[model samples]
Target: MGTEKKEIVGMIRGCIKTVTCGQKLDLNHKSQNDVVKPLYTKLAYVLGLRVSPFHRRQGIGFKLVKMMEEWFRQNGAEYSYIATENDNQASVNLFTGKCGYSEFRTPSILVNPVYAHRVNVSRRVTVIKLEPVDAETLYRIRFSTTEFFPRDIDSVLNNKLSLGTFVAVPRGSCYGSGSGSWPGSAKFLEYPPESWAVLSVWNCKDSFLLEVRGASRLRRVVAKTTRVVDKTLPFLKLPSIPSVFEPFGLHFMYGIGGEGPRAVKMVKSLCAHAHNLAKAGGCGVVAAEVAGEDPLRRGIPHWKVLSCDEDLWCIKRLGDDYSDGVVGDWTKSPPGVSIFVDPREF
Candidate 1:
């Protein structure tokens, strides 16, 4: 077997930048680079598309995307997708207009910094660390309501950097205000299930790092001032700037779900759990990408509007089977299609 990393795009004239290239994705494994994108089956993922500064306005990018799509089909991939920030119109046009791809889903990636103090200080329910097998069971119970849900549960639970899985269980059999029961917790009395909320964490410190550089000195000054203010008023929730010298501790939280009032409490407890884990591991942030329409998205803590980052998911399907069991319609345009946000894609 060939061990060489495949390279499709040649180096630009006197420059090291590759014109374009992508990778074959398998959801059963973690990304070699740790950006948490997961697919249900095999697919082609276009990544790190770049053109030299001297190579502007040419058809090279379009050609590269087309060739990569062909490579996907030839390799038995049923679909291909690319993820990019929503503001990048140039890349968007190249994929949707030139390469026959369409807008599939727009999801937001949210980041929450873990401080020494607990952000989710819920006292009613206690979070219990779960074994992988039990965690998979809890995930499946909540999976049906989600789109783009991971098909391989083991990949998520057993990934090398996975910290742990957790469930929020009532502190005691009898529930009360002191017991941490909320109005929504009553639903479980009528229709009982194993637990209230479920969540898992992945450590992406080695697989990922964030970069933030200001174009001008004024912006840098303003950022520094904000950091100073954040320290002065610890509860201000200012965004943390990425340090060039230090890789931010990044842990990804995924498969988050809960029912009703208990769900809210669970979200808090789970976040607290994640924060404690991140703190112990020297991680600075815990993040997750979720569908904008998902109610759970509203629960995960973030810096109001500032911490919400949107990314466009573009997909092109190659097969004709759009039966009930299958995921999406190959015949229709990508917009308005149901999407499952895999946290691994963060």
Candidate 2:
């Protein structure tokens, strides 16, 4: 929003521009030889483009996107990206049909209830909190294992809202694995696992307060009443699922990374740990965003599927040289491109 000043607004008659650069994003890192190479390109993110309803259908959207593309080109940006809901036809058409952008990826933003449902915690894995300097260890471990991991490790570790960084590994295996268990006891690393995971918790109560909508009056009343009882009568353990009424108090996990066959198990352990932290902080839910095909999406225990909680990612190339290996044509991008979404950018 800081980019919305007078000169740029006057040029577009009422448009805004936001450009971000100087971060390296990994496109494809999966290799048989254990050598991970990155795409190494600068990204320009264009968001908050709006055209008043009174000025609709007058090629305003097309002109706005064109201006941003030109600006990105002049500023040495190789890629331009945007995100929106999958069902937004108007915005979709403006980007794909007019702006020459390609449908790059569709990622699932999973949300988990902190206390309502059961979370299966792993006994073999132990999650421990780390100091700010230990954040470098997390970056190195994940970068060696997971693909599409962001290169901006310092920003995540030093963010104002970052609670801490945590790593999940086999218990009692001090090869950088720390001690302590959540909710119960654990055993030593006897089984020589294949993978590990690292996660960072970002308190989102001040940022991501959901506003429940489209519920009947009676339903809203029932949801609130049930929540009150659930809080009061802990022994009864009544099913107080979140609905369109309770919308605040959330903690989000970013930089979810994992590898190997047992990667999903490590992810589950981290989810349980993050959930407990959120509950202690008086939060209602825990959430994260993962690419639709990433194992972390299947690894983390999330809300039931088909919950209308997914986002559409679209990208366009600003530079003429397509040597970056990004599928220039949207139709040509099979199975979608691998992506990493930095929560700080949101």
Candidate 3:
């Protein structure tokens, strides 16, 4: 029995790489170089190769990456990609020039104040808390907008975590007046107790005002009906529904990141609504992650670049037959694109 247990342990150890950390390594005896390798799994990401500084410019980097690509292909990665800073010329050259990886997507992080005062008073819109029954209506509006992931609506109904979702109905519409104006022209205003505090206060106030305004008669009717249902159906014991005046959060995965007119309009409405919610919710800050370049930084001079970090780029070769493609405007092609979100989130 002891011998059998030892054998099992040895086999398990051999099957998995021994490591102080989770990262993998490639040993090149021919070149006498140690290459830090990226391991690819169906669920895990494959990171890019990092050559030792001492072995720099010796073609080791290329060799190591090729090996990693092979590993990815064998593990069945549908696609692989790499990311580098816009300023890092050498790394960029190696990937695009030598390794033949094309530009996939650019991601940036943007923040907005939740307070009314931080936002331009002229562009302010209203935000409201939603009830469970409102989920279907919100879903329809979101789908019509074509601005979010398809699964988002389902996820909402299923009761996910602290994720706050809301709808931006314009003031006169059946949904009510949502945040108006584009965020591109709007500037991020800074306040004391940090910016987030001010934004939260603003959201709470804005939500209260919208509720008092009776901006949408249909919404008011719905609210009253919902109340009647709650009182009559004692067994239901439903959760407290969010009123129209409460501000909420928005998460945009794809549609609003670009620079086209539609993208701008969507972002504008989103920001306006987000600001209103922030004020009404009395939440201090509203946050958004923008891809490509920092539009607010580039467009608005006063907005500062807070922090930037590169996500790890990993790839493994799934098959020997794979080819990235003949270059020249690969973004138009289907396989030419790659989408990445945090593994934990996915």
Task: Give the top-scoring candidate (lDDT).
Answer: 2
Q: Between which residue pairs do clashes occur in model 2?
A: none
What are the TM-scores, per candidate, against the unseen true structure? 0.71, 0.75, 0.39
Candidate 1, run of 10 with poorest lDDT: 12-21
Candidates 2 and 3, the one with greater TM-score: 2
Question: Which digits, one per residue and each the tens of the lDDT, describe model 3 over residues 1-346?
Answer: 3554422111000011111111234455355565443222232133334655655787766666666656655655434456456667777777667876766455554444332333432232233444434443433332222211222333334343323443332344332343332121112111101101001111223222322353477876765566466556646643222343444433222222222323333345546555554545455344443333434223211123322333323222233332322222222333212132321121
Instruction: Tell me the lDDT of model 2 at 60.
Output: 75
Please give, for residues 23-93, the per-residue lDDT of candidate 1 as tens digits: 22345666576332222345456765787656657888876666776666666666677888888999898
Off by over 4 Å in 1: 1-42, 116-120, 174-195, 215-246, 321-339
Q: Provide the global lDDT of candidate 2 against the true structure.
A: 0.65
In terms of TM-score, the best-performing candidate is 2
Clashes of each: 7, 0, 40
> Which of candidates 1 and 3 reaches a greater lDDT?
1
Taken over the whole model, the C-alpha lDDT of each candidate is 0.61, 0.65, 0.36
